[model samples]
Target: MSEHLTIVEHPLVQHKLTLMREKSTSTASFRQLLREISLLLGYEALKDLPLTEIAIDTPLTEMRAPVLAGKKLALISILRAGNGLLDGILELAPAARVGFVGLYRDEATLKPVQYYCKVPADLADRPVLVVDPMLATGNSSAAAVDLLKERGAHDIRFLCLLAAPEGVERMRQAHPDVRIVTAALDEKLNDKGYIVPGLGDAGDRMFGTK
Candidate 1:
């Protein structure tokens, strides 16, 4: 497995995370907190982005400066809950190319079925970061990665707000090469496939629906 998983434990992130977990937190606050947490999480996820030295001038002297290496980053949101994390990451990496992968859960099979997917061309050439809020069963996430791989995404990372152990294990088994970055690793999932103590259906919560 790639050593790409990093759990950010900053006080601010933890604090907001707590508020987001509360059953009483309003949808507006939940959305705002998600955005804030995404920025913090994104910061941790992009810490190792390649950097190259460039000749530049300071206020008083010319010097070599470091800048992001290679082509721009590509942020792909595994909609629609992924959009929550996508917003803040975009704020941090405004220039990064954006893409979307929409998958819906199949009630009978309990697997993710792709409904829509539109990614940038030449995925193998760009560093792609896939964002989602809850990595519950990891079925959708894994399927999304599979599609990306089919399209030639060699270097890809999965980012999420929360993850269940089962989901993590599933992803590890399915795609050991894909690194997973999340805010918290919750306990095992419930019989219903929901992460224990999870904030509950991310899409529903984020949109203030049932």
Candidate 2:
């Protein structure tokens, strides 16, 4: 989590990602793949969580066991496609508090427009992970982070399925302290603000929309 950007290059992650990128992949399969890949990315993203030792009684003996330190984690999904990643991560961290930031791009300007936002209280005390499937233009992701900071979330990390260099740079310039974790870094964004060679529009494919 200390690194500014971490690409999860695990074999399983890459394999499923390949399936997701295929145009002929069915909606059911796409959604399933997203869920599976999410678990892998979630594992990498949460690896650095702080741990503290606590005394516990094992069936055989008493010992100090390590457990997650501090408050429960806060997961803020960036609406729509973010929910796909959120579902699998929830299975991994069922105790985590969940929230959502609703944003959509302005077709002409390619800027984020917030429609809804509701997050857990005391964000300053918990570790926050913002989930989104794609970091295409980075406008929405950066803006989402801005809103979280305004709500007092300092320890924040960003998790995505794919990232474009433009999006990564945008996040770095906008919020250098936040760590970014993704499955892959594609070539570059297309003119229309989509990641080149990405798995199409994540939300569209996952939800079976146009």
Candidate 3:
């Protein structure tokens, strides 16, 4: 697969994202907006899915119907935050195989440490969409992708609600073949390694956690 980065610029996505970015947006509202925006993001990500024809019965007669080619996709969520994008995408692609990769950054070392990983048995044959709301430092995101790659996931796509330049570059350097899809690409990462003007900690906003 070719390396790509797509910034979704739909009006609806932009509007909901603005509301979510407000400091005063509540957790419930944040979560709701994420679900809605994810639907739009998924649409863009799967725009070019290959199509194949199969025999099918229509209202009047039997005919060949066009359907997605290749095996069903594997939707891999990168722990808690990725769940937000996962849910909406699941609604869009309910037949997709679901999986999760749990990783946390060490406070001192600032490196990702895997805590959990469970994926479909057919992961190697299916294209994978890795979901995470924020791509900040990219260390954890790239690490999660590494785990999937080790499992034989060559066709991988990284999906996020927001992305920082540093994080995008990091992922590009590490996994140039994977496509990166996001609702918005922000300016930069702040001193604390947070996306500047991002929808604050996405997990915190979505789940009301500290």
Candidate 4:
């Protein structure tokens, strides 16, 4: 990956990440941890969200409150595993619009092919955040972004639980303007295309299966 990619490495994020990496962690536990960590990461990811001041009651008196400003956000979950992180972000940004991009890998090409795509209104205006658990080779994630851009989403950001260096590098080269917010960028991808030292198959772990 390019040395230019920025990663959120807060201590709390690291501590939670360790528990998620443990082999003994059950699918249920893993899913719970993923939700918790995703929320934490989303907190940092959305720190720069524009906020407008509004008058509100503070029990004793009316005070100015900060509420999300401008157009509402669009949260796009990159299918299956991304749904795990999507749920937590929805809790944080309930009013945010939702979208989905389903990419199923082709057995022969070993490449992701879009099975389905549905986005919210005003993609040209809203700031869209795409969420997925793992970004390994970058082919699927980059393809997903391409589809979003084609649909008029100019401003985009990617949020992930973990990323492989190769994926990070590819994303940077493919789309340098789009910021990639990840918890950690691991070493490399193994022969079978799994991230080395990764928390196994994220979908399987979250869903409680092989």
Candidate 5:
């Protein structure tokens, strides 16, 4: 286990998260708020991105400026819920490469079952940011990350809207190198393995499928 987690406490992120947590909030409002919050979280998640100074000619004068160091970032969405975060982050990092991993929870096993996966061939070359809205048991997140690692991804980060302590611990034990960034760390997971005080099923809430 390792200390590789960040809790974002921006006022805007907290405010929108509060709105999303309300049981009475509509699907449209929840989706919109999620988009807004993801933008903020994405900004925080990318704060420490490697940078390099580059010489460039500005309108005023020629000078060196700091720019992202490596190739374009790779954003991996963990199925349905991750899509919500993916869309919002894409609004900010339009040039970033995108990928998807479809992992459905098997009720009996309470583990992730990957039904779909496709990523850029250069995953090992660029920084990879994996997005999932909720990290409950962490089995799926861990499994997804394992798949990436198997594909040669080393520099990786996990981003989520909410996380439970148990899930965080699970990730810590499973993959210490991957840093986790979340908007809020909730108390615990419920009987059915949902984050306590979480915004219900993120996929259901965001898509009005509940």
Candidate 6:
């Protein structure tokens, strides 16, 4: 989590990502793979969560056991596609507070346009994880972080399925303190601001929409 970016190279994660990337993969299969891979990515993302020990009694003896410390995690999904990643992470951290930021790219400008936003209270007191499947242009991701900061979110992390170098650099420049975790970092983005060699539009694939 200290690094600006962490790529999850677990074999299971990579294998599932390959399946999800295939054009022939069905909507059902893609959605399932995303959920499956998201757990692995979430594992890497949450590895550095602070821990504290507390005394607990075992069947035979009592001992100090470690448990998560500090406030409950706040998970903010960056709209529709982010919801796909959100599901698996929720399964991983069932008690995490949930929020959403709705944004879409303006085709001509390639900038993010926000339409909706609703977040949990006391963001400043909790660690935040922003979920999104693609980090193509980084405009939306950066904008999402901007909104979170406005709401007093300081400790934040970003999780995604795929990232382009351009997007990574963009986030680095915009929010250097926020760590980014992803299943894979592909090549540069296409002219249309889509990650090249990416699994296509994640929202479309996951939802079987055009």
Model 2: colliding residue pairs: none
lDDT of 4 by residue, 1-210 (tens): 333455888888888788998989988888888888888888877777888999998879999989888899999999889999999998889999999999966656658898999999789888889999899988889999999999999888899988998888788888887788888989998877778798898888899867
For model 2, residues 19-62, the per-residue Cα lDDT tens digits are 99999999999999999999999998999888999999999999
Residue-wise lDDT of candidate 6 within 70-89, one digit each (tens)? 99999999989999999999
- lDDT (Cα, tens digit) per residue for candidate 1, span 1-210: 237456778899889989999999999999999999999999988877889999998999999999998888989999899999999999999999999999998867769988899998888888889999999999999999999999999888889999988889889998988889888899878877888888899889899989
- The best-first sequence of candidates by lDDT reads 2, 6, 5, 3, 1, 4
TM-score of each: 0.96, 0.98, 0.95, 0.92, 0.97, 0.98
lDDT of 3: 0.90
Please give the lDDT score at residue 98 for candidate 3: 95
- In model 1, the runs with Cα more than 4 Å from the true position are 1-4
Worst 10 residues of 6 by lDDT: 1-10
Worst ten in a row by lDDT for model 3: 1-10
Residue pairs that clash (backbone atoms under 3 angstroms), model 6: none
Model 1 clashing residue pairs (backbone): none
Off by over 4 Å in 4: 1-4, 57-64
The clash count for each model shown is: 0, 0, 0, 0, 0, 0
CA lDDT of every candidate: 0.89, 0.96, 0.90, 0.87, 0.92, 0.95
Give a tens-digit lDDT track for model 3, residues 1-210.
234789999899999999999999888999999999999999988776678999998899999989988889899999989999999999999999999999987867768999999998777788789999999999999999999889888888889999999999999999999899998889998878889888788988889999
State residue 117's C-alpha deviation in candidate 1, in Å. Answer: 0.6
Model 2: residues with Cα > 4 Å off, grouped in runs: none
